[model samples]
Target: MSKSVRLLNGSSLCSGRLEVKSDQTWSSVCEADFDQQDAEVVCRELGCGPPSVLQGALYGEGEAPMWTKEFQCGGHESALLDCRSSDSDRNTCSSGRAAGLTCSDPVRLVGGASRCAGRLEMKLGEWTPVDGYRWTLETAAVICEHLNCGSAVSVGKRKEASRRSVWSIESDCIQSGSLLRECATPDHGDSILNLACSVPNCRWRC
Candidate 1:
């Protein structure tokens, strides 16, 4: 058993059927109302990464004692247990529907004046900096999208590189990928990216 919620019989540490421990018993989570929001919470709980896919019971049907509680996470929650709302009643769960998820590496921005603007950072075994090159409004577009801030209003390139910038990005990022981690490249470089985002209710996820 893991110290916290874990994916049972998963292909990797970050992918598998969602499971939870209650009353000292491990049970599968019912797929009812499960969506990207729910998966994000699960990934956060496991410290894995952002969600990639939500396959309904594709991994396999779980055994008895299904957890029917509906977990409503706001994407920023640290754990599923910390979701804003949930129910513990198993009677609401139906049979033949379990939840599964696939997650990739996670990405974040830091060192900026605000959450929406900063040097791009990524998590791949550790936190590291991402080089700022060929950046454009498109780049800001994707970033703002993640922050749920509609789209980028402006991009302010920093004159000096941020401190401890050791990684550089070298990919054809054109505001396409859902998570910034989807971008390619594996080299290190020193560059600073100062950005600004605008959207309704953007402050919530920023």
Candidate 2:
């Protein structure tokens, strides 16, 4: 069972390599099977808002017995230990590629019905796609700001079908205040990422 959790090597408490304390020692979780859903639990466990950003091995890995138990959290678990898990026994997904997390801030917007709502396309020169998962107040705030949407109390996630491939982003955004165009993002060179955002009041005028 995971007893405690914390972020390591990140510039701030809101980001870093995912590590869990169990049996009195610190260990890293497997990153291959991890995603935004799993990341939501980490931020919530740390009292941070929804996960705004994610990166694999962004902190340069870790030493460990390597946690093989895959975590299943609904993005609301008070503690990481309370979430369910089972042994996966992975080898390719090791500590050298530990996971990294960042809270949301001003994000890139591509397509949607309103200025505030649409599919996220962060790559600078061209548009790309992103994944949809549980979002928190903080994360939603960033997206709204990027789109000039009023400060909304809540945000909802929607799904879509895009023929494009997922953007291959392997780095954490440099700053919370900075949006996608400012960052160095490489294209997956395929299709849209598929995550959608919807906000209230600021309907698309154009």
Candidate 2: tens digits of C-alpha lDDT, residues 12-52: 56678888888888878767656777888777666555686
Q: What does candidate 1's lDDT look like per residue over 45-139, in tens digits?
A: 66667787788677777674777667787887777767765655557665557888876546665776667666666776688766666777776
Off by over 4 Å in 2: 1-3, 91-95, 104-206
Q: Judged by lDDT, which candidate is best?
A: 1
lDDT of 1 at 163: 50
Residue pairs in clash, model 1: none
* C-alpha lDDT values of all predictions: 0.66, 0.59
> Which candidate gets the maximum TM-score versus the true structure?
1
Q: Please list the residue runs of candidate 1 whose C-alpha ends up more than 4 Å from where it truly belongs after superposition.
A: 86-92, 107-206
User: RMSD in angstroms, all models?
Assistant: 8.0, 15.7
| TM-scores for candidates 1 onward, in order | 0.51, 0.48
**What is candidate 2's TM-score against the reference?**
0.48
